[model samples]
Target: MSSAGSKPALVASSSAASKRQAANSPGGHVDKRGRTQSNDEDDDEGNDTQPVSTRAWLSPILPSRNELITSPDDLATLLATLPGAEARVPDPQLTITRARHSIDSLLDRSETEASITAALERFIEAVRERSTERSRYPIALLAALPGCGKTRMCLEVMDRIVPAFCSQRHIPSLCLFLNFNSDAASTWRSYEESARHPQHAIARRLLQSYYGGAEITTNRDISVNAALSLIRRTEARRQQVLEQRLHIFIAMDGATRLVGAHVAPQFQEPDHAGLSLEQANRRFWKQALTDLQVACRSFTTPTWMLVAGTMSSALKQAVTNSRFFVLPVPLSPLRAVYAARLLDIADPKAPSSRLLPWRVNSKLMARIDQAAGLPRTLLHIIDPTTFLDTRSSVSIDDATLERVVRDGVQGSIMQHDSDFLESEALLIYRKQAPVFHPDISRVERPTTAPANLVMAAMMSTLHKLQGPDPNKAFDLWQSWEAFCAIITNLRILSAIAAHPNSEYVQVTNLFPGSTSSRLPEFFVNASAWRDYSEDNPDRRNQPVDGRVCLTPAGYTGVDSWCTVYVKDNNGEYTPATLALQAKLDQVEDCVPLSTQIEYIEKAQLNCPSSTTIVALLTTARMDKFDPSDVPPNAFILPRQGYKEFVACFELIADNVWAYNPHLSSIPRLASQFYGKGTTLAQARAIAEVVNASQSLDPKKQFRTIRDLRTYLEKHARVPNSGFTIQSIPKDAVLGWPYADDLVMEDSSITR
Candidate 1:
């Protein structure tokens, strides 16, 4: 449990500065950004302990079988003896919860725990063979949200599962763990230096440990060969070691540093020194990592590489663009039951030790659920310094627990906002003026939207809706209707909140809008029931469903115009100048839709943008709605035999921001919108893929788009859905009697 050298002065003091040390150092306090904060200026001059070697500090040697730390418990204990081990590894005393599946687990088990275990076993089998196929090697990227236990999972498999599997076959499994943010790796400027240097922080410890502290040299090839060579030489020493071959697993944590601004790039290649962080990342992944993986095949031993990092756009892009075969295993959030066990408030090992006030309490479960199944958030809530006295057996009331949980959730959200603000670099100008603003600089750019609070708000609403009281639970109609009413509002607000230039981004209502009433809260807030007038000159006189207005943080000038599309659609989607009409009652005729199209056509007049006007008509119930009655340039909701009104909000959410209107495929939209047996969970997956596809090249997306079209065409519901074109009256106007009162403004339900 101990290193040969003495500890550094970083965490040796009792002073306040010592407490601010980074999370990696023992006794170091983690800052709001999850980084260890240290005061390097304050040195512990009194310490006389011998300094640890550069190699040891940079790369800690992997623990061998001689240590007898084979189980997860043993590994956890060993980790605890190391500085900041608690921050890096999960406590073995707590139950290890399997991460949720990103895609529908019913269809794909590749991300499941069983799948990962099988993959690890396969790695061991590959190691046993003298000449294994390169594809047999496990090259995985364990991706997850911050605090979702990516590191813990890696350690568990490496330290416990892999070793156990290898032991049964009499094969030795060795792991060399590296953290990019470690003292050694952080100082590395270029990939070449990191890979080539004899004392390279990336792999020196791995070499020193396996070669018994021998001086390992690098060759003309990429530096991974040093470790690969060590494994190859193991065959010559097999008689002395008493093993057939070695299973070497290389795990790299904090890999996000390699791609993003986490590390200050010092390019060794002269031509690349001036490249941006993003460009540098792309090249590093496409070339450096690819070469490293390719070099792995040159060696004989079964060696797999597991790169772990927080899920981010930069990390995802790097992995996706890489030519290397890397299976990305994203960790899902913890379930409430598992989270409860972590808190020791439910399922205690001993019945006598279970606290009476908290043991399996429904209120406690509710409080834990507020964390949205994130273990880190739960840990924050249970942190004794912040929330509770875990040692206390005294009675704790529900109200106190509720407050603690609420505060923890809010704190997590605030931290997210703080991080977003620090990284955001755009100017927002609200759309207040009627005339199109000539200043192009004022236009708001598409940015990372703040989704934490929006999700938290949504979770809270869902919780209340499905609370203990049966009466509060939503019926089928209530669920779809309520969701449709406010989803657009939530989407727009979330986008504005994340925009760096938005003015007055604040949480006015915990639940921003409710669906109890007929009209959405957006219209109600403006004291109108049917529609609100947009400041844009072209649509100034037109009464629309609702509009979201956001001004730049410090300016009153308009930057972006987000016109809410509250109605239904046609084949192509041009989000700009689009209008949506929600039909709660049955659609008995096409007159209403015809009138709506005329109004939108009039609004499209003299439009400066190339984007065309589109309209979507949504209805929960429709009678005798003939395929021939549908209007051109318009789309009808619940196209015969489809009843997924609730899931369709995902489409609306994707297109809410009018600034970037990606003309998504109609077949793809329909596949997701009316795909039989689609659940809310599946809808979320579709939305994510749809959003991601927007950034990809059109040709690259052809496969996915074609697949979705195929699915839509083949589904049972497609047979009855007609596609005949119908033309509406050219003179149709917005003066239809029923349409006038379709959307009305009432302040009675205003908050």
Candidate 2:
């Protein structure tokens, strides 16, 4: 779950090697059976469950297996998988790497960029029109999350696609690519000058790129006036050639620079300027676009601009959806298929199956998935220096894998830790520490600042939980462990909440302990057992009873919680703090939903912020359920819905311990727990089964929950046809005999 939205699912698979190597391999031809076979191997039917990863599955397809791969390092180097390395600039033809290496593929956003090529060509053509409407042509705005390959996509269009289009139309073209990032090949001094005179900075870049390193002795030649004069001079020169129109394509990398210090100057405009920084930035960029268009019109030279930037709030505010065509680059994690293909190109011999399958080793897969499919992060995680083991058969041990992942995650978090800290503190500050609450208070709020309040709440809670002669000193590791525990539980709750329609029972004890006495390991870290640290007993002899206050989730720190951006049906995401309370059925201590809502409302009264407080109450027994006890908006799961409930736990556990890459397609792992749609279907199905039962008892519908489940399974047995009951129309769902007959028929099929 990225801040942008839940990312598209990633497929994990493996391939033998790159296309060039595969093509030259001995006996690479297909056999009479139509399967690619080598001279050294005998033919065998491929496993359906574990399909071999082939380069044919790749976007810019590479061929099947390469026999050259011997180690993981070879694969990493071949793919140029290095963390923190920005996208490389492609050659003018866009068919090769900067190093002049022949490259037949662009993996990341090839489909999207290809699809938008026509639109880009139209934008260029529109700007090049001989009519006066050139001034109305807006600059193209490309938006994407960080590391989504925006720069690479923009470069492809400007350097390759546009040039091709111009050549086909017999138009002369010159492209000036301006990268404003500090480390880019841009003029860093000129970017600094943008603070005062941005137009001059643009003028200098234009002159610099146009001259191709020729000495422009005077500053006057690089001024705004000189830039327009140059355009006029070029247009007049081009007029000598009959019907030849000069098209100037300009691409601005890191367009976010336009909204920085340059925006303050725009705020001074009398009537047209906006009051806020975001509005000022928007107005400034729009004026910049208009100014460029107006300048181009002065010489009747056609010009088109492409601005690319990350999904920053300021960028979102500046680019109006109506005026400019906004293209969102998908930054989903690498799916199994992509991963498999990547491995194939990298090292064909490296064991990919162990790494790709979610169920194989979840903790390891989770770390790989946490890279969020960004090339930099993925490279960092699988970097040969840390990940690949050359000692024996390129195997990565548990200890080394743990360290590598921990370091990789640390590196990722460090990049955005400051932003995460600020956002998380803001969330807690907005909670306002309910007035008159037993543990929290208004006095705890700092008069001078809100940042310390988060720390205060954490420390305060830690002190209470410590019990008797507490360790007052801040232990960073202990604090971190507690934080992880809090985030893990909140994520579990959030996943369950996502599917309110589903109900689950039977909480599988994840840690090694007495199931009844011990809480989930995620809820109780080793630090919590302070007194018996050396022994580290599996479970405390005493009942696991206590309240644990936790901080709200943030973008960094905890991997599972970091990118889980769960949004409501209304398509709005409000970061939340979860409070969970549970009781055994014999305990009869379940809290009502209304009281929980009241507590939240009361807190909101003091500090009205977007932050939400979610409270969950669970019980071990379902037979004690009472209609009057359940609130109208609250969801209660009977024992009959226990399968779905347990599925939710399994989903969460898989993600944390062992992830099933196959289930990544599910929209919200939480909704699956709630049986959101599944609950309604189950209810209707059960009602249908019970109503149509042969029993004469009128209250058969009110039989024991177990009996109802039995009737449901016996009557409405879903066919094993790779489709859920939810996928079938309710009217078409037959009961008993019909369902049994369909199941039998489905079993006979080849599938």
Candidate 3:
């Protein structure tokens, strides 16, 4: 009996070992004895009795599957369970230290040197004065076009002047740099979260600035109240140093962002519907400004705020309304010498000899200054790595230099970098609009139209007129009349679009008075047309076609004029013949000299004796036309005359859309007219136009005009194929005398 019991025990031990091995294998099972069981045995056990659910093997310290968070609510619940998770506070000392370091870093990166020191000194002077009078804090507003180094100037002032002031006076001073671009509240909140021991945060940031090796710390959660408390503590400490008053220098960059955020609801709301994007942005800016104001006021420290940006009128108003002592300092472009020095510092790796070539040439340096007009822009254009080509032994040529300058300016304008183009276009439009309507002090803003569209339209009009094969040319008188009509129509449409609230009239009803009354003041003046008619009694009776009529001089009178009418692709009439007298240089093919001469001689023959016919030339110099090539009596009016005509148009268009509600649609219009498919072809065209206009070489302008003509031919619509003349009854005195004379001759023959 003992041997049999021993045998069963041995078998049971073997079975247990086998089960344990099976449990350790993949997809194996564990029995109640903590021994592994094979799949076959488990299946057999399942067949014999109900199968038990296996518990997942989990470590005691690890979270169970049920406790795993899958949703935001679950995560929140888990966070809530942690100690001090809800009331995580940021340390104030870290925030102030980081802000100071940021200002320092900006100063360190700046390439500006002695050139910006004047502006820095002014800021320093203002800060020092603030100590003398607690209520008389100087608010210096540094205004400049974008890329003019305003930010760099601010940084340099803070870094050099602030530290120097503190050391000179042996007094404690607080310098705070705020970028209104970032949300003030959220930034503070982030600082609060990231705040740790003040020493550690400061040391870490310093290390990161110096060596880029510091590990980033997590932001500590701090309440708004805690932040305020820190500000209050700093303020109290600042007040204690009354004998050596704590001079506060607060520099605010992009102040436009701050003031715009707090614009009132009335300013934002449109008459038709909810706020537009522009209005919405303004509202946001107004609110942001309010928040910034509140936060700044909360600090009891006597502060001298230095605000800088391209100050908009709205921002200017806000600043004035706030009762801040505004000391406006306008930043101008650096002198060529100063700019060249800056370039040297910006690119230390460049060969000193190679760089000297750019400085020695006064013309080249002047060109560079004109091209960039701003320090930051110049730096961007002449980036050391990209601008300098070490492999090429040849020095830069004038053409290459010219090309670079053109490219830089065009690129800035095309990119709307610093809002340069938009501001320029607006200025041009504003200046031109008031000449047409002297009573109108301000142009209505385009609500639907965009700025680019307006610019493109203006460019397109110029392109058409200046193109190789310009619109049809009528005789001088006829051409002038046609141009007037076209301009008037465009102005009316623009006016209506600009001011939606203004009264509307049909195109036919635009000029309710007589035709002569409808003409612009320049045209109505008899002296303006004295050369064309030469005091002829029957000037109005001149034939519309190239046929000469009997004037006071006679039927073949020398003073008689003939006009050639030309229409543009849009079927708009313009005085193309007015430009006929303009000199043609390499562009003779566009207007053959021989053909023009022949036409002029023919018109002279039909005119009375001593007519002294003249043709207006668009070329800058009349010398382009050889004296021997034309009749002795025929004179050529040079480009200066053409400019005068262009000036007239500019005056009429200035400020027409200054306040247009549809001003935003200009970009879209430009895109539609010049853009290729959905791409940015319009921007390229505009850049090319700007480049051509700024080019010192005249050949580039000619080429640009030719290219523009080709572009318009490919893209613009053809003129409509229809013609109808509508005539209204005119007074007998103003009517054509030739028609009356012909009627009398016919009647005499019948009698």
Candidate 4:
């Protein structure tokens, strides 16, 4: 792709400055915060010739095909509006909408309590601290590849973070979270539009949840960039009180523009001179901090907040490390994690066999875990619930645990067929399937309507409403278009990996080369290309109108074929049937509860929530568990506050957090009482750091907080009023986690 002209963002460099440029340019480097480079990526060294757009490559990995109504049109609108001058119309068949949905689904399904709690703790500390020696970055960027738990982690964080202000009647403190979406990549909503505009929004209502009476300001003029501007400006008002103390945590999902955006605010654009395309598009992120400062200076008290965004590593690293903050959260023992959750959930029901850490027996499962490096994938992609259900009862036996590993791996593999089908279908839909495409007339087929009904319904809902996005109102990420694109794209990839001639598919015209072919081609080489014996003009490459077209096997009715027997056309359809039918001619009026629920949850976690979460929820008729019933930690309240008839209501907060105090975001006194083993580890790490930092004796300092404070005061600033008793990281000295991230040690790691 040619470098376009100047756009809105100011940060520069989509990837970090490194000798090893990230394999995925706009994502993160393999060695950075997001994305675990698959082995396949390493084996291929000369991939520079491929497309620069990660969306293009990753689009095919999704596995759905519901044609979203008006979604493509909305994307097209954005494409047209971005500052870059481009008549290069997006492929009408492009499933950008659905691609978004798929990503949201995968991310939403994989959240865990521990991951969520830790992120909140870290975020809260960032909000409270002002020191410079420590990394006091307000933007907590979590980047990862597909199936990684970054998005899930954000949800977990919101669970804690939102309540911070909510409990204080300052719920609107939650700021806007721009879903870093490709479809929306071209054009952005203004600060006001983003907060309450219909269509894939993620804030405002969240504020209402926390502030109770907070309403979407009817007179407000919020926009897409507003949240970012707010987050970037938050630091300026860190010490402000009242309205100022209310922070806006804008969780941007795909902050690919971080680098450029961050830099843009700092760029001194001559008042009369327009920024170059690069300056606006890529350089803005570096100045994001400045733009934010400029925008936020006018707020009442000034909103002190953070930008909690989910990005791929390449995208995350694009910003200059010296200018911004980045955090990499690696996957831990997932089996152990899942086992613990399952044990908790199971304990409430029946006698259960003790669940153990899931040790994989399958090479594929191990390979996958090693490649993705996240446990959420195992949970969602593998469908742990299904694995557990296979038992004679709900319990996971030793045999069941072993079997789960095998089944989960198989599930991941089975997904390829569907994955590829959706991918190729999207390619077909974009280039080969669009009725208006030059090649559309070449093949005489049934003409039902102008749009895919199911897709339309899905997209319509997504574009319908974005409430007070800042406040975590309905902070979900799934939308109709995003879901369709994700599922369809994934299906396409699955198909590509499974094709018999997968080796030669890429070079072939998108549609498989022959009618006899069961799968589409996957290779990108002419030398490896296999020619079809009986060439159908459509299947083989040919110039139609102007564009040369190859009908990829999964596209143009190949995968959209309806079953021979139609059960009923009354509009009621089974997913099995929908999966087999030709693409819908128009939007479906209703989506299933199960599908809608998934959509809402995903939307809650992605950018879609920014615009249309409430609509999505209303349309789906979805119900959120009472905040008190949700997992991890409930919003803590005095018993009198939560009185059920002043008698019947359960004290959910104590009930839930009591089970896993680790999940609580509030700094509970109990956490200070670490287990012996945990304490030992903590003490050891502290000792090492302190020893190195001060050359002090551990025994002497261990005697009293005063002695240690006196010793550290010589080299550090210890607050006079309060006494802190814990270890901390060197980074925490001025940045995050207040003083707790550091470990006091007789010998510190002189960071």
Leading candidate by TM-score: 2
lDDT of 1: 0.35
lDDT, residue 155, candidate 1: 56
- Candidate 3 lDDT, 3-29, residue by residue in tens: 011111101123543443233222433
Worst ten in a row by lDDT for model 4: 432-441
lDDT of each residue in 635-678, candidate 1, tens digit only = 34543322222221221221221011022233233222332244
Residue-wise lDDT of candidate 4 within 1-751, one digit each (tens)? 0112223222223333121112211222232445443211211112312221342345443222111111222222333344432423211112212222222332212334444345445544544553222233333445433334444444434434455534554333443323343333323334433232221232222222222212333333222233232222222223233333555444444454343332212122222035445444433343233323222222232233234332232344333332333344443223322333332233233323423212211222222222222333344323334223111112222222222222222222123222222211110111111111111011111322553322222222222211112222220111222222222222223223334343322322122110111222222221111221113342322112111123345332212211111123563321111111111111112223444334334433422112111112121112332433322200111112222111110111112111111111222212222223234344333333344443222233222233434554443334541223433222212111101212322111111
Q: Give per-residue lDDT, candidate 4, residue 332.
A: 25
The TM-score-based order of candidates, best leading, equals 2, 1, 3, 4
lDDT score of residue 100 within candidate 4: 28
Q: Which candidate should be chosen as best, given lDDT against the real structure?
A: 1
Model 4, TM vs. native: 0.27
Backbone clashes, each candidate: 28, 32, 73, 193
Model 2 agreement with the true structure over 1-751: per-residue lDDT tens digits: 0011221111113353233223322223343467754221211112211112332233122221222222222422322333321232211222112312122244545556654565556555565553334224545666544444556666666657777777777766656555554233343453355443344456555544443322222222133433533432333343333112456677666776555435333222332332455354454454333335333332244556666765454554455421333444333323333543343344333345534322222233344433333433334344434323111122222233223222222222222322222111110110111001111111122232433322332323322321111123221112322433332332333223233333321112211110122121122211222112222222222122121333243311111111112245675543332222221111112344454445434433322223322222222223434456543222333333332322212212122211121221222211121222344344444434343453323234222224434544555455542324443222212211112122322120001
RMSD of each: 20.9, 24.4, 29.0, 29.2
TM-score of each: 0.40, 0.43, 0.37, 0.27
Model 4: lDDT of residue 531: 24
